[model samples]
Target: MSQILLIMASVRPSRVADQLADWIHARNTLGLSIETVDLRDWPLPMDDEPHQPKQEGFDGYRSEHTRNWSRKVDSAAGFIFLLPQYNWGYPAALKNALDHLYSEWQGKPVVITSYGAGGGGKAADQIAQVCQGLHLEPVPTRPALPLKAAERTDAGRLVDPAAAFAAQAADMQAALGELAAALHSA
Candidate 1:
């Protein structure tokens, strides 16, 4: 199976990031392997290695968490980052995680699924730059999920299972499908 890491980029309490990730995952029908990776489970600290990741490599990763996470990135053929915009940017945790690797991410295809005020387009653009710097292929066809039209709220609780989110989910799944095809050709 061509592996694709579905990264849940938000780790906030009472958020819709995971549910959004799940929506993309459930709609995947391309037969590619999809593994959901929640950054919350991997508490990676700041990038403080003696040398850069390109020079240090996975063997230089003294921390077990870093090494294990490296392996996951190394194994993936593509990625889908479920981005929850914060102050018009991606979460710090996601940035730290992406910064912790080098060769493991080289040449891999990545699709951004951004959700927030105005669909997190600013964050998507910023992340695309970051991915390019890492030598990763950032796909251009990103799907945006704006909170007002896409999110369902009931009694002050955030819910995303309503029919309103279906359109956005479908668009993201299409982007994911394109990523899978790009990965095969990459």
Candidate 2:
């Protein structure tokens, strides 16, 4: 099975990143095995590894949390990051979590689903560049699902969910599955 790790980059109690991820993952992924990693579950502080880990083998981090995170990344065939734009960028939690690992991310194809009032394009763009530096393959077809800033959610129901946005969610999820499947073969 092609295992894909779905990461939700939000720790805030009311943030919508995980909700968005669930919304996306609920669709058909053509039988792909899906797992989840939410920052809220693995709250990481600033990168505090005692030493940088080995690049190829992925060994050396002193922090158990970081080691666990690396193991999670190493286990997945690919990834989907639900990065919610905060103040025109991704949350520091996501950055810190990413900084904890190095070689584990290399060559992995990541599907970045960025959402925000301003389309979360900037955050996605920034992370793509970061991923490049880490030698990870951010998927060529980046899915930027921009949500309205003032969009409301009451007990999980989006107050004004648009048909276009819903369609985008479905389309992006489908494309992401296809890309992940192809990457898994490579």
Candidate 3:
């Protein structure tokens, strides 16, 4: 069975990406094993690698962090990026994570799902461009969770991710189905 990684791409202390990820994991009916990987736990330094990821290639990574990250990404059959939109784009942490490894992401199936005030369409589209450069195959049904003012608290925290994004549940499932089909074809 292929395992699908639900990558929490936001590292903010008050971010609700985790809540969304947990909800997605709990609601999984696709039969594929899903694992949550929070970028906060990884804490990879910005541009720490001595050489470009492409230059290093697989097995040529000099840093243990890169090697471990490489292994984790290599092990996944597909990825569902639980991204948070920041300034009309995805978080830097997510971009840094993607930049740390090269071949590990090549030709892999990925579903870019974003959440923000405006549905995160811009952010998702931006990341899709990056995915192209990395040779990661992205499905067309990118699910965007649009957060409304009423859905958030005074502190800008989510009231409840599951309830907030309930309407988009079908869209998410469709994205997951697309990812499953992509993985199967791969």
Candidate 4:
């Protein structure tokens, strides 16, 4: 089975990022194994390591936390980043996480979902550039879920969810399908 890694960059508990991640995990139909990793839970100190990740490798990590983090990134097949636009860019934590691993991200397929005013267009673009630099294929059909239209019910579920973000979701899923096909063909 293909593995899809969901990286939740938002730290806010009530944020819609988690909801959107869960929604994607539930809707994926291609026997893709889903794993959600919240950056908040694995709080690492500023990158103060003596050597760079590419040079020292995961084994040379002085911190056990960093080592564990590297392992998770190394094991994933593809990634879906849940990014919220912060001043027209992706969060520092998300960038830091990406910087922590080099070899793991090479040639991986990455799909991004951004939420904010204007549907996180700025953040999505910024992240796409970073993904390209990392040698990861950033899918063109990125899904942007604007903050204005996301509805949260009293029960804590997103209301009118399917129709609310169907267009973007469908686009993302289609991109994932294409990525999967490419991986299989290779």
Candidate 5:
């Protein structure tokens, strides 16, 4: 089975991105292996490489962290970004992570599962453009998990991802199915 990395894009101390990612990971019915990559574990510096990722590519990474990240991205067949929209865009960590690698993302299918008050539609669109620049193919069904006032805490932590995002499950499932098909065909 092909492996798809579910990248938890938020690294905030009290963030709820992991809860949403866990819910999606647990509910996956497709036969593909879904691995969750918490960005906190990687802890990559923002744009620390001497050369641009395009110039050095994967094999020519100067930093050990970039090399490790390259290997991880290269090993995956597809990706699912468990993202949170911050100020109508994605987190800086996610942008930094994407910037750390280059060709490893080429031609790989990606599902941008964005969550926010407004469903993160703008963030999804923005990331799609970035993905295009890096040559990652964006799947058609981008799942947007919207959290209302009652769905999240005053501190912005998700109350219960499973219950809050129940309505968006079908979208997530469809996106996964599309990713699986894309991987199989690739």
Candidate 6:
């Protein structure tokens, strides 16, 4: 079975990033298992670990937190990053998460769903570049969920109760399927 790791980049409970992740997970009909890892919940510090990840062995790491994070990234066959534009770029927390690991991210498929002022499409572009540097293949057909269409609930969950966002979700899922197929074929 294909496993997808959804990285929730926004700390705000009601932010659009998590909502977009939920949308993808809920609408996934491809039998792919989706796992969401919230940046707020992980709370990994800046990449201050003395030893590099490759030297630590795939399963061995100094900190338990790093070990767990690395394992999650390693297990995923593909990734979906729910990014909210901050300062016209990806958030520091998400960058930190990416920096903490090396081999886990290499040669994996990645897709971005961004929301912010102006829909955060630019931030998605920037993130795609970063993924390229990591040797992760970023799918070309990313769907931007603009802020206007997304609503935040009082309890801090983003809700897109309309059918419009479904198209974007479907596009992402389809791209993921293509990436999964390529990975399995390789």
Which candidate has the top score in lDDT?
Answer: 5
lDDT for model 5 comes to: 0.87
Q: Tens digits of per-residue lDDT for model 6 on 1-186?
A: 778788898886446565567677776676777788888988787876777666334445788889888888888988889898887897888989998988889988887778775778889999998998888988777767666665567865555534647546667667767766766775
Choose 1 or 2, whichever is better by TM-score: 1
Cα error of candidate 2 at position 20, Å: 0.6
By summed lDDT, the worst window of 10 consecutive residues in model 4 runs over 50-59
Give stretches of model 1 more than 4 Å off: 56-59, 151-162
Misplaced by over 4 Å in model 6 are 55-60, 151-161, 164-167
For model 2, the superposed segments whose C-alpha errors exceed 4 Å read: 56-58, 149-151, 154-157, 160-164
TM-score of each: 0.90, 0.86, 0.92, 0.88, 0.93, 0.85
TM-score of 6: 0.85
Q: Considering summed lDDT, which 10 consecutive residues are worst modelled in model 3? A: 54-63
lDDT of 4 at 21: 79
Q: Distance (Å) between predicted and true CA of 9, model 6? A: 1.0
lDDT of 3 at 129: 95
Writing each residue's lDDT as its tens digit, candidate 4 over 85-186 gives 999998898998888767778888888888886789999999998998888887777888776676778865578667677767777678667667756764
What clash pairs does model 3 have? Answer: none
Which tens-of-lDDT digit does each residue in 45-140 have in candidate 1? 797666567544335877777888898889998898889889999999999999988888888899988888688999999999999888889786
Q: What are the lDDT figures for the candidates, one per model? A: 0.82, 0.74, 0.86, 0.80, 0.87, 0.77
Q: Write the per-residue lDDT of candidate 2 for residues 1-186, one digit (tens) a residue.
A: 777888898788777665576666665456667788888899666857766655766567787787788888888878888898887788888888778888787878888778887678889988888888887777666676767643565764455444426657665766676666667678
Q: Residue 26 deviation, candidate 2, in Å?
A: 2.2
Clashing pairs in 1: none
lDDT of 5 at 49: 89
